[model samples]
Target: MQVKRFFAADMRQAMKLVRDELGADAAIIGNRRVAGGIELTAALDYPLQPAEPVKPNAALEAELRKTQAIIATAQARLSLPEGLTAKKDCQLFGERLDDFKNDFTGADHVANRVAEPAPEVVGPAPVAPHAYESASQDARGLDIVRSELHGLRELLETQLGSMAWSNMQQRQPNQAFLWRRLQRMGLPATVAHDLLAKVAGIAESQQAWRMLLAHFAQAVDVVRDDPMDEGGVIALVGPAGVGKTTTLSKLAARHVLQHGSQSIAIVSMDSFRIGAQEQLKTLGRILNVPIIPVGADQSLTQALAPLAQKKVVLIDTAGLPAADPAFRLQLEALASRGLRSKNYLALAATSQAQVLKAAWHSYKQCRLAGCVITKADEASTLGEVLGLAIGQRLPIAYFTDGPRIPDDLHRLRAHQLVSRAVSLQLAEEPSEDTMAAMFASFYNDLSRKVG
Candidate 1:
């Protein structure tokens, strides 16, 4: 866009020049009234310039004609402003319009009149000119009008109130005796309510402790972790005793049980763990699935070669807390290869929401696909767990109910997990003692010790 400035004796003449020269569709960037007339700035767009201007020829002439045509069209629309068009004749036209018949007449046909003065017809009787048009009384009467206006007002109010809940996400407070304490804390009600819901879920929200758990749980969001299903090399990675080995066995067992054992191979990253390979080997022996142990980075190339024919490559990684930088190093090695990768940040269901968040932070170095929750049967405050997952944007794929291999493991869904979490929260008089203990424990063990 390029701007062209035009100043003339008046705005109308300058605008006409703009249309005559620049063409129509030129955007008015700005206009201001000056002492004499007006100053106008306009913008126009044109095609890119050629390397150099062509001499007058058929092509150049054709371009000129097109440009001239566009300018002519623009000139036709440009006119003097309405204020400049005001003249005494314009005012007279409104008053003397057909002897005031059309000026303000409510009645169109003079003969078809009502005897009761026809509500002061403007054209025939010189109406007061202030009355506005309205529908005559109907069967529904004012009842319909009143109801419609009430609904319209309510709808408008609702739209404006939509913004009221913006700051209330902190979990709401309890509605009973707890409300006073909540007000004193100056906490937003939504957060208070959410915390109260968590209290309700755990049967733990008390007048005093309701806000605490709600705040904690609201701070967490647990997602139903789902691992990638794409065919390629897959690894189950997590900290020691987080059930990485068991999770591997469960997945491998399913593959072998569903497809034949010959179709799958298990590559263990933990060659150093005592009996880890042997334990997996034992499962392999029972399941009749082959287990490949990679001792070092180079060994993966050889191990992966024999399993090339396998439909799915399940790599059971060495279980190390992501706090260990070495775990990321091994993960990088797998990523170095063309193998598709996803790390399962396995978490124990009984783990505190704070601890789960810490575990997620520890595994932050790895590209975590989703979470695998274990030990869910031991805890009821799944809301805290779900909250943690949601806060981290981690999807949960599978949850292990216990030590059982295939029977205990099931993939989690978002709606199902939230529903279950809500149910647990809605359970009658959910306990708050557990929440109090957990909060105090963290404060004492972590904050106090560090401080």
Candidate 2:
């Protein structure tokens, strides 16, 4: 087999060049549009035995027919006149053709010499998929070869990624470790780098950790204390299955426990779910507080009229996808109706960092007052929630770690939340090898500073 490439101002000129040089025996393997014109890849094949009879297998006969028909159609479509003149600006094309011919014909390798094109022993033009598919043994062998090549490509890519990571680890051990730790917590690269850049000269590992924590603590916006104490209308909003209803119930329960059941009223705007209103009602019954259901057409202002005397009205909104048209429209409807509400995005701690960020971004149209982090007990790492809290500058209003109504809900504390993040790091990681030693050293440095 021999491979060659040709470039021409147009397909007609390229076909003319191919016909004059390689003749009709050359097959156009591939074509692509170039800057000035088009580029074509052509190949020729020479078989050993010329007098051998062609035996077509039953299975491959259909495929070969299809392939031959397509090739024939393409050839007919690109048919050129025999009297066509070659372009005088063929200097560039001639140079490339000569270079490819020299590279193929002048090769010193034994295999290359064997596969060299011969003038008299012209076989079928090189097909995109060779005769391997037509022969059972060759087909099976090529399948194994293709699989091995795929595995080799994956292995190479993995090796390259590892090499790049290794280089970073070697050059900036401290920074790399810190970055990886934050990333493990589900922080985006952009957020992680921004946090790292804020850290100034740190003589000790403890200081570095503390500085980062302090930065994280300061970076997070917190409502501090119970939001219900200062709340009027607080709504829990987020995507589906994020525990919005559960978090809203938890908040309502907490408000009732602190300020009594009479002053608190829980409302469900999630009429989409079959038993969503009932779920909130069940919780409302448990707390002996009024539970109201608001429909899409019903005026929220009118619904809250009876609860006007209540100190806190917690709204439970329908959980929706970020891209859902109803998601933005619901918020707009409330705003247009002059229904004032403080939206607290109920985010699950077990969610990926990007997912949590997306929730925050999507619900920002509602002008989120703060966030309620849920499913804390289910999460192995609080990094995602913590990263989200700090990165979005949205204060952590409440946390619901368990299914317990008021028992699981607690107001977020900056120092305590930061402490939990560090504790999660210690508990989740094994205290073995260099990584464990690094962690131990980090804490020991902090202990010394504390002393």
Q: Say what the RMSD of model 2 is.
A: 20.1
Can you write out model 2's per-residue Cα lDDT over 1-451, one digit (the tens) per residue?
Answer: 8778889765545666777778899887766567887677787773434555554344333433443443344234223333221121122223322332233222213223333344554667665474444455544433443333333322222332233344435544676667566655545444555677676346465678678878876776778667677878888888888888877777776777777888888877788897888787788778998888876778677788888888888888888665778777777755543667888888898898768878777778777778888898888788778777776788888877899876988776787787777666633432122332222233233334444
**Clashes by residue pair, model 2:** 221-395
Residue-wise C-alpha lDDT for candidate 1, range 1-451, written one tens digit per residue: 8789888654445666789778997866656556765677788984445566423234323433443443343233222233321122122222222222221132212112321233444565553544222222221223333333333222222221221121111232233334333333322333344454444433333634644544544454344323334456777766677678887788887777676787777888886687788889899899988888886656566678878887777788776655677677776766553655666677876776557777788676567777777777766656555655655777677877777777777875555554455455423432242232222232223322333
Show model 2 residue runs off by greater than 4 Å.
1-164, 322-325, 426-451
**Residue-level lDDT for 179 in candidate 1:** 30
lDDT of each: 0.54, 0.64
What is the Cα-based TM-score of model 2? 0.58
How much is 321 displaced in model 1, in angstroms? 4.7
